[model samples]
Target: MNKLLLTLGFVLIPLLVIFALFMTNSVETQITLMCVALVTAIIIGFKAEAFKYDYTTFLFFLYLASFLGILCLIQFLFHVL
Candidate 1:
């Protein structure tokens, strides 16, 4: 149960932050947040030992990194084209 809660927290906290950023209705802020999330995922992926062996934890960060990568790409396309 404790592990479950911790997993939920890893998912929910970012979702909540994204929710708040969406509420602001600022594209720049959203893009910035995405970049930050992507970097954070990378840092955590390398520095966190648990991510090395824990599949669930690895998936969570992988999901975060990929999702943020997509968002950043879309934002880049929007600005360039």
Candidate 2:
């Protein structure tokens, strides 16, 4: 179960986010996926860890996801400019 959750978090979510970013061409869809990814990361970040090492990865994921919305805005601005 732990491995499965980790795989979904580290692999699946990013894949979906990247796929949405390039494949949709819809800014709304891109933002929604990024929001979902951020929410998932937040859930993982807040879960009580079964092991000490768990927080390490979750923290990193949270850190990265926290910037996703800002990244979306920046990319939009770049394209507009």
Candidate 3:
């Protein structure tokens, strides 16, 4: 169960996010952005673990916020520029 959650945390969640972004724009740029954010979250979560911090729950929230923030920023930028 732990391994499954970790895999979902590190892999499936990001894949779903990227899939959603692709569905939204069907553009390479949006896909790339989502992939980058996913990678960033994975790196951060791993780092927190390496440092022996109790970060699993917090990492999930952080990843979700970061994902939403990036999407919002992309939409805002597209509208503004």
RMSD of each: 4.4, 2.9, 7.7
> Which residue segments of model 2 deviate by more than 4 Å?
44-53
What are the lDDT scores of the predictions, listed in order?
0.62, 0.69, 0.61
The TM-score that candidate 1 achieves is: 0.47
Error of 1 at 50 (Å): 4.5
* Residue pairs that clash (backbone atoms under 3 angstroms), model 3: none
- Residue pairs in collision within model 1: none
Model 3, residue 20: C-alpha shift (Å): 1.4
Instruction: Give the lDDT ranking, best first.
Output: 2, 1, 3
lDDT of 2 by residue, 1-81 (tens): 665665556676678778868887767788888888767755654453423566667667656766786778976787678
Clashing pairs in 2: none
